[model samples]
Target: KEIMQWIDSENSKAKVQSSIHNFTDMCWKKCVTKDITSNMLDTTESNCMTNCLQRFLDTNINVVKLIQAAQK
Candidate 1:
């Protein structure tokens, strides 16, 4: 049982990492329209990425809440 729990924890971590990677790729494509001239993001790109991440988190939270409610 402990080994199974550890495996599940690892799988969840991997899935979270994969989701973050995919979200970063999507936000980059949507926000970055110009060539990479600087090491840091400008205000527009930064805001866009922030908003994208916020929306993603919000959606995930709502889904989780809904799932929990349904399960209960």
Candidate 2:
């Protein structure tokens, strides 16, 4: 039982890490408009990254709201 619990805990951690990685990759792809020419990001690229994160979070919120409404 303890071994199974350990496995479950590890699996949950892995899933969360994978999700974070996926989100970061998706956001970067959506935001980065040009090739990385230098170490510092340009203004547009920076703003795009911020916008991407905001939209992503907004979408998650909307989905959760829809689910809650459906449950009720």
Candidate 3:
């Protein structure tokens, strides 16, 4: 039971991390818009990526809260 629970937890973590990576890749493409082969991202690019990730997580949290409230 414990091993199965641990595997499930790890699988969930991996899925979330994979989703975040995919989202970051998308956000990067949106911000870059060209020469994705470029190595280093500029300050604006970096900031945009950060904001994109933060807002994505924030939106998810807000939605979860709204769903919980509706359920209650």
Best by TM-score: 1
Best by the lDDT measure: 1
lDDT of 2 by residue, 1-72 (tens): 999999999999999999778877887888776878889868887888778777888999999999999999
> Which residues of candidate 2, in runs, are more than 4 Å off?
40-51
lDDT of 2 at 29: 86
List of clashing residue pairs for candidate 3: none
- Would you estimate the TM-scores of all the predictions? 0.75, 0.65, 0.72
Better of 1 and 3 by TM-score: 1
Residues 17-57 of candidate 1 have per-residue lDDT tens digits of: 99989999999999999999999999999999989989989
Model 2 steric clash total: 0
> Candidate 3: which stretches are off by over 4 Å?
34-37
- Every candidate's lDDT: 0.96, 0.86, 0.88
Span of 10 residues, lowest total lDDT, candidate 1: 50-59
Candidate 1 Cα misplacement greater than 4 A, ranges: 59-72
TM-score of 2: 0.65
**Model 1 lDDT on a 0 to 1 scale:** 0.96
Candidate order by decreasing TM-score: 1, 3, 2
